[model samples]
Target: MQSLVIPLLPELPGLVHASASGTVWAITATLLASAVATPVAGRLGDMYGKRRMLLASLGLLVVGSAVAGLSTTLIPLVVGRTLQGLSAGVIPLGISIMRDELPPERLGSATATMSSSLGVGGAVGLPTAALIADHASWHLLFWISAGLGVLATALVLRLVPESQARTGGRVDLVGAAGLSTVLVCLLLAISQGADWGWASGRTLGLSVVGVAVLVAWGRWELRARQPLVDLRTSARRQVLVTNLASVMFGVATMPVRLVQPQVLQLPTATGYGLGKSLLVTGLVLTPTGLVMMAVSPLSARISAARGPKTTLMAGAVVIAAGYGLGVGLMSAIWQLMMVTTVIGAGIGLAYGAMPALIMAAVPISETGAANSLNSLMRTVGAAIASAVGGAVLAGITITVAGATVPGQNGLRVAMVIGGAAALLALAITTFVPRRRPPASADA
Candidate 1:
């Protein structure tokens, strides 16, 4: 959505860099709150009530959307986004609720179906937002988001059943604090690296501090009765390798986010860019997500047939091929859409496999925490992509307004890097076993 209206940032009144920085800040706040909220909600659901938290979260999202739509300043917009970030937690909590309430055969599919909402949200958010922003007003985007949130809340309250998965573990506040610090530090480093230079003191200090905090948090979780994340159980070969592969896939395949905006945003002078409006760009990308949604069920089928490891490897290979094909196919906008669809298919396949791999490794009780960490890896990978991709873009200027002209050299570099990273992921995933051996908790 931000990408759609990115060129209009300079046009928003009294908002500093509304399209780029303001929107980035909005999503940054959303994702940061989500990083914490998802795990917290999952754990809380296991304790008090999942439905209670889920409904309450939906309320928060409504408030967030209204607040964002009404906001006149950047900071408040970010705060509003922070409130809406609870969407991240809702699905996880829903999964936990279903596991406790539903029968065994239905649990996995239900969890997967609910989790696919992420893709749905992304697919819907962008183009819808662009259309509203272009024709109706940018505020309408949040209004729609809030309205949908309200509807979902009502439906959940009315139809979705609650769970009684009671547990006695207390909130590990200190551990959560440590991990949040680590996330903040690492994310900040990635966000600021291109702008501040990788060698800068703030980057170096924060990176070191992040690592130190994570180390301390690991030790603490090992000893704590109520751990935020149990590293020991998470380190088993199946879980560990799955998590590692997720991080790689996350980092490797995110070039779409980087590529889509540049491809659409580039001026007409560039031979590559179609120079279509933001809405057109979003429309093109939207189908990729739709394709992802459709492929998710197929992905589940693949996981069932080929095993999660094979599905993962196949996803990686396909992703690499998608990127490779993209290199030769970027001459036109439709070609961009086709390549993205391929990439999205790969994502759907891998995402479907991730949970299966996780379940195969850990005790049922620890699934939420393990998956939360897996989610964290993805967020970290995306942050890195954002930083690196931004740097690549910033390095080469097309000079449309200046005397000296340049081509779309920077964007091409970034896209090729995306392909190369996918290749790297394919290589790594190949070593993952098919129907890998079960892992002991301590292993």
Candidate 2:
């Protein structure tokens, strides 16, 4: 769902009969909704049932896709996207379910595979969405997504069993509201800072309000009987370091997504631009996803043998290496493809290990909320990367003919920053305690 509208972004203004700025809400709404929903859904999954929450999320996706498919205006599309975003908890919930249903011997590989799906979907979806947008009516994209959602819902109902593991507790409505407010305010500020003027009153006010609310929210969570998130668990050295590394990995992942497509599709008249079409750009990046999938088992094996910490550190090293290579090799499509593929492999290794680390630290009862918090940390990292990267790309630009575009220097700088982030992740992972045997779900 994340990549579904990216290919059509340039045309959305015309399609929705709105200004570009107005149509941007379609994208922003999804991010905001996902941020707010992920942890809340996870907590609900723990309290109710993972399968039940999973189904609920899928239902929302189906409804959202259908709404988006039928929309001719920005507001309805944004509403639809928000519903789709509510399904963001599915991945972490799936990971928690694996913890409940799968035996210890199979848990590592199963969770690894499930975790890697994030990259697989995005990488594969990009080309698929691009192809659909290129050949068919754009509405067909959402219709297809809705169909897939239905199929997935059916399959899950038929095959997946609801786990007996449950953390029976009342929902923390107050904590949920507090966290939602914090996320919305902070994300809005981060996401729109460039467009709204970073120093503007609106941006600063939101930032200040978000931080203030966060402090209050932290105190409330600590005092609540059934907190939305277990703050004490999250503050543990293992969980804390792992989440911080996840954030850096998130930052590392963003530049390739943002910079490569622009570099590929920029007019060739720009000295360094490849000038590939959108379809070609998507095809080039497809290998990255394939490589990530192929590396899942390897990630699991390394995590099993050397521990998730080692796997994470190795992945960070590989990602840093990929970005370092990217710095010197931006002129050719094959070079960019090679860079992305290497980075994807690194991501596959890192992503697969992260959940293992989190699960190992938290009890089975808290798996849903714990894993969701980890996912949210990554989301926060991506938001930061997007903001900083946009500033960099926009800050350094050159004119081609009558058009202003990001300069080659800006692309190189972004790659360097990506590499630095990866290295930072590696350094942080070094502080993560070595893995312990995972806690059994029934324990």
Candidate 3:
């Protein structure tokens, strides 16, 4: 639902503009809320019970979707979307639960499937939302989301068991507050900096304050008995580098999302544009999600055979190849589909490997928090990708039918940048320790 709003914007600019701050908050609300919710929910899941928290998260999703579905105005939409954002913790929590409940040998494949669901949901949601938007009232989107959330909640309640892992201690309230503040400040600055002007006082001030708060937050975490994030475990070579690579992979994949839809939907009179409708555009990208789901088990097999580190590097290469293909292949729908599915394949392999890599390095007790932090790193990378892609597209624009749109050259530049990020991730993955360190409580 968060991502569905973006592609829907070009189709419903008027309806979005009718909202509180226009469509800006439509995307920002979810991004900011998710950034705040993921780590905090992870901590809560760690301290209490994972299944209980998972249920709570899905409940938020159901309520959020219902709220958005009923609203005709922007404020209500933003509020509902914020509620949906709170559910972002589900994936990481699910991964941690698998780590705890599944057999050691089964952990890799199970967690891989869980991790791939993140991409799968977004991939399927985009086109599915587009189809509904094209065929019915836009409000129906939320109603459908709510229904699915209800179904997911019921299935999880029936099929999944709560993990026995526990880190019994007081929830570090101060750390949670500090981390939330830092993330909100940093993401706000990044997401809005382009609009506010990158060098503007508001952007720079928030950036500085976020950094200052982060320093203090780190100090607080170091001293706390049960920190929201276990910095020591996070600092280990394998854990640290995997997190870094995850960020880069996030950065690389996000632009494909932002750029491709625009290229596909732009008017053909623009010479380079494919001139497809929003529904058609979504259909083109649908295969990418299907491929990710299909490739996830294969990704697990590769990780099992060669270790997750190899799987990650191979994913990075494939992602870079996809972006490289986009630099030339984006002119035709078939070419775009091929490019997106290939990128999806790479993301499937890389996302599947990340949890395995983190789990190997961190103690079982710390799995929820550790996985949450890794998830947060990817969120950070995605935030940066949105900011960078926005700036590039906004800077280079052409007037089509008296309205400004991003130039074809700008789209190519974005693809190239994405490829570079994939290569950077590949380089970082190389630094991850080849051997897993023994997991201990102290780590």
Estimate every model's Cα lDDT from 0 to 1.
0.71, 0.93, 0.88
Write the residue-wise lDDT of candidate 2 on 1-443 in tens digits.
Answer: 88889899999999999999988888889999999999999999999999999999999999999999999998889999999999999999999999989998899999999989989898999999999999999999999999999999999999999988888989999999999999999999999999999999999999999999999999999999989998998998899999999999989999998899988999999998988888899988888778888898999999889999999999999999999999998889989999999999999999999999999988889999999999999998998999999999999999999999999999999999999999999999999987576666554
TM-score of each: 0.90, 0.99, 0.96
Off by over 4 Å in 3: 10-21, 437-443
Pairs with backbone N, CA or C atoms under 3 Å apart (clashes), candidate 1: 9-19
Error of 1 at 184 (Å): 1.0
Query: After best superposition, candidate 2 residue 395: deviation in angstroms?
Result: 0.3
**Alpha-carbon shift of residue 265 in model 3 (angstroms):** 0.9
Query: Cα lDDT of model 2 overall?
Result: 0.93
Question: Tens-digit lDDT track for model 3 on 1-443?
Answer: 56667556655557645743476787899998898899988888988988889999999999999998888778898899999999999999999999888888888888988898888788888878878777888888889889999999999999999888888788899999999999999999999998889999999999999999999999999998889998988998899999999899989988898899899888987888888877787788877778877888988999888889999999999999999999999878889999999999999999999999998898888888889999999999999999999899998999998989999999999999999999999999999887665487554
Across 111-162, the per-residue lDDT of candidate 1 in tens digits comes to: 5556555566676667776677668767777788788888999899789886
Supply the global lDDT for candidate 3. 0.88
Provide C-alpha RMSD values for all models, in order: 3.0, 1.1, 1.6
Candidate 3 matches the true fold with a TM-score of 0.96
Q: Is candidate 1 or candidate 2 better by TM-score?
A: 2
RMSD of 1: 3.0
Q: Which candidate has the highest lDDT of all?
A: 2
